[model samples]
Target chain A: MNLLLQLFLSFFQIGLFSIGGGYAAMPLIQAQTVEIHKWLTPLEFADLVTIAEMTPGPIAINSATFVGMRVAGISGVLVATFGNVLPSVIIMLIFAKLYERYSEQTLMKHVLEGVRPTVVAAIFTAGLSLLNLAVGSISALDLFALAVFVAAFLFANSKKITLSPITLLLFGALGGIGWEALGF
Target chain B: MSGKPAIDLKFYLKLFWTTFTLSLFTFGGGFVIVSLMRKKMVDQYGWINDEEMMDFITIAQSSPGPIAVNASLMVGYHLAGIPGALISTLGTILPPMIILTFVSIGYQAVAENTWIKAAFHGMRAVVAAIVLQVTWALFKSLAEKKNILPLVLFAAAFVALFVFKVNIMVVMVAMILLSVVLSIHETKKENMS
Candidate 1:
């Protein structure tokens, strides 16, 4: 198969089966890019994960773009990203249509009623996992992280002080630099 | 509520710009994007109400692919049909596609920088905090409905994930079935009465 064709097919498969979102898609990405195609070394793959986490947009897009650029070039980037996003766009279009049509029906409402709470639970779990990553562990809690978490939480929940997400993220980056400067 | 506002060129541009900036700033993965979208789409633009946003999220999360892209598609379609969905999705993927292409050129520098690491550390904490706030808001909305079943399902879902470590897809499927069955039983009881 052509390299661009290969990239498309691999990412198309990745996007189709990546039902649980970005993090869940990581292993499949690693297997295809690292083990199967040898498009990226293991170390490069690890770095890709970090870069994906730090950069904007979803990890799947990041991974696809990175690997595609590595393998081909700008064309590779377009092909790979389109492959990854195509599955999602198609799937979501059908879902959006169905949801708009039936969302008002009682059965659909009850299904949403059940699913909504689980979504909340999933978000809560994601928060806890991120917290664990930030603090390292409860035994050796990072006080700086705890303080930042508390302050950001308060700011977010406050009525009088409204800050955009970007503003909050900038403040966080500054706090990190200050902590590093203080050598703590 | 009133019908969706007219889909003019300005509306299309706003849709593009909204998802564009949201995609550019969304770090720390899927849940982080959700928080930002809630703030921009629901709180700021008033494009969708809180309940509708929740429904969009539910569908997005449950569907395939990245939650951010999926959610953007739904929101776009809701506001302005297929063209809106395509435009919003284009905005959503462009940042990562462009940034990662450049980053792929010199990622070693980025991956090894201590200051960058420290900054991400701090950002991670804030990301967690933002998601926590969103979770609380969702919980509060569910509580406001004055129903115990959803509350019970919430707890059950938590325990299943936190304790038993069940896969999220499995838990989601189980909950949907349970909810549908309960809805049927309630309707039958109402009919009998």
Candidate 2:
């Protein structure tokens, strides 16, 4: 299959199905791009995902562009990005008005309320898949990462201190820099 | 042009420029924006403060639509009105849009490199920790309500997806249907009494 076509179709599917946002899209995006297609290494994909999270726009959009660029080139990026965004853009443009009109209806309200928790579930799925991809085949580093995970988790859960993602990222980067400097 | 001068084209332009420039650098999505917006707007430009930025971020995430994009839009709109909103949105979107477009073009060849592979390995591990953190935060937020329904739904959904290998879409639809049935039944019960 043409690479551009593949990029387009894959990203289109990603955006169409993402439902909750970039976080929700992570698992499927990883499966399709990394596991099935081998378009990107798990790490490269992870890096791009981080960059996407850091940069503006949606994560799915950021991922689509990264994956698309990797596969096809500039034109490929355009196709893939368009594919990812097209679904949401078209849906918002077409349905926003209609949704607003009937948004107050009881059934619609209840249905959306039901779907909200599912969004969180979907996000959890994405987060776990990302964790698996990141911690692969390395016991010590994985354990260290796990320690950080437990620390961050307990800190947030028990202390309610909120170690924001940015804080963890800075600390992780500092750890990396420190390791590099130590030459261990 | 306005009498009060509290709101004007210059203020709108400044807001637009700030959002556009900040949007260019922020990738991934919500969390990155929190830091970057804090740095550029709060620290550098002094458009907002720590508390205001935090408030804006919380509001942006809770409201409908993409959090970063919405934040830019709301901030822009707040500063300058409709025009400010348009310019800010455009500014926020333009950088990543352009960079991603370029990157997508040559990403395949780039993905195959060796060092890229090694770096990504470490990066992925770090990202996993970050992701875990994201989930834990969400769970904590929801947990406080003591809503067993949501927790049950969460656990059930996880099992359906991981253990049963049931399709997520199918599970989502099932949950939605269940919620509707429950709502209707409750309404009917209330009416009968």
Candidate 3:
């Protein structure tokens, strides 16, 4: 019972305070779930990040669902997902209603502009922190993982290769399975 | 609202079903689903014009939440109303909820298997890579504009977050306040000039 409340209130705070969409929310989510609640360790949080990507819909939805289920089962899924999305639902509803009226306001424009770079920085920090965990704690700088990372990173950023993210994730999984199966 | 079909059962069902399929299939981040939505809402149906679509995208992209959810809500509301928004949101979120439910339930058994463990280890790397890719794209977007404010803020934020280990929310709040001040100051200077 208390667990459900904790999940709801924590995610609600993360969702309400979070800006710049799902990816941008990673840092805050990590802090709330990993640092504050101790729901999962850093390495576990990294896995959650991967799972969030593998699933569909919003990053926040996937993540909150995963964390919720981990904490409280199906009901946990319901609470966490709702808690995280409640803000988006309400705010988006308001925006949907008044988009034309307030979108062009100077105050709004400045806030949006201000948020973009902060989001980027947060994303970078999250990625760096995750990578640091893999190197410093989880694995000993596995070449296969690094190779997969470089490949997927380039594929996503480069226009020429044109492979989908699922394909990239599939290949990464395959590479891991094969490497480990071979006793390497 | 201004130039679309009337709210009807068919419209609601179509909106719900289309987003359901898209959410079910779309893997990875919000960007992929967002593109599919543009195709469905703008190119295929012609429900919203290009300008209106662009507005929705801009506003949705910049707002809080997942890009797909935000975009769907905007499109759904534009097409119908509150109910439309709810249906579209349900469509977008339901698929993942079902899929992740299976994952969350079965994940413990899967995690214990060695081969699956290896695969997940690699998948972990991929997650980091995706974040790096997103970071690169975000930085590039700011670079293209050559705006001093964002660049400065980005540097300040990076330091505050990574080096000093400050709370991310604090840094973001400071940046928002700074931008608001800068904008107001610029407007004042322009008026004086």
Q: Per-residue CA lDDT of candidate 1, range B79-162, in tens? A: 888999999999999999989889887764575688976776677677667767867877899899988977998898889877
Cα displacement (Å) at residue A162, model 3: 3.0
**Stretches of model 2 off by over 4 angstroms after superposition:** A99-108, A136-141, A148-164, A180-184, B1-22, B25-92, B101-123, B173-193
Pitting candidate 2 against candidate 3, the one with the higher lDDT is 3
The 10 consecutive residues of candidate 2 chain B with the worst lDDT sum are B1-10
lDDT of 2 by residue, A1-184 (tens): 8888888887877765554444766766776687668988766677777666444577766777677666676677678766765554444433323433533345545655666666677667766766765554455356545554555455544555766555555565555445445553
Q: How does candidate 2 fare on TM-score? A: 0.68
Over A92-167, each residue of candidate 1 has an lDDT whose tens digit, in order, gives 8777767756433566557666677776777676567666766668789898989998999899888899986557
- Can you tell me which runs of candidate 3 are displaced by over 4 Å? A102-105, A137-140, A154-159, B1-3, B187-193
List clashing residue pairs in candidate 3: none
User: What are the C-alpha RMSDs, in order, of all predicted structures?
Assistant: 7.1, 6.3, 2.7
List-wise, what DockQ does each model earn? 0.44, 0.31, 0.65
TM-score list, all predictions: 0.62, 0.68, 0.89
Q: Write the per-residue lDDT of candidate 3 for residues A92-142, one digit (tens) a residue.
A: 888776776852455566777878888898889999988776544454666
Q: lDDT tens string, model 3, B1-193?
A: 4358767888788889998998899876677777778887788888888788778877777666677887888888888888888898889888888887788778866778898889887777777887888889889999889668678878988988889988876787787788788878877887799
